[model samples]
Target: MVAIELKIGSFKAEYAGKMNLYLSLLDRFERGENENQSIGIILCADKDHLDVEIALQDINKPIGVAEYQLLLSKEELQTLVVNEIKASTKEEG
Candidate 1:
């Protein structure tokens, strides 16, 4: 099983905003220090790109928006991509 960090601040934030934040955090988390097989989000009232920056102004950690699930890890996705590329190359060749 995977882990998720859900952050909620307001209602307007919605799930879409949370997903975007998840992707952004995932990128950072992948390189930064942390356990694998876990995900996060950053919730807020609005997601104006700048809003997210401000909301995450001075905070950091395995955080998520709201209504969460155990999403796959970056390494897992990368491995899948590499495998797909290899398979495609082999098929073409």
Candidate 2:
């Protein structure tokens, strides 16, 4: 069994605490339901590597932290398209 937590902003200590508790609870209640040991994953928009390290140092559970990417904003997409068009035009000329 696996538990995944998504965070919009950044990694924090409290998140680790919550994950620890949740994993512990799952172990207690969902025992024998999952063949393998339960795992937790934290997906955040942005995270500080050091902060995540310190947050999970004391905990005795399996947890992983990773970052996720959001779709580009309208303005950013438009800018990229415009740049591509300009570059193409220059190459053709």
Error of 1 at 63 (Å): 27
Against the correct fold, how does model 1 do in TM-score?
0.28
Q: Model 1, 7-92: lDDT tens per residue?
A: 43442334444554555655656644554534444434334565445544454444444433325676886898899999999999
Residues 1-93 of candidate 2: C-alpha lDDT, one tens digit per residue: 798999978888899999988888888888586466779999998999999999999998999999988799868979998999999999999
**Candidate 1 clash pair list:** 5-64, 7-64, 7-65, 40-64, 41-63, 41-64, 41-65
Best by lDDT: 2
lDDT of all predictions: 0.51, 0.89
What TM-score would each prediction reach against the true structure?
0.28, 0.72
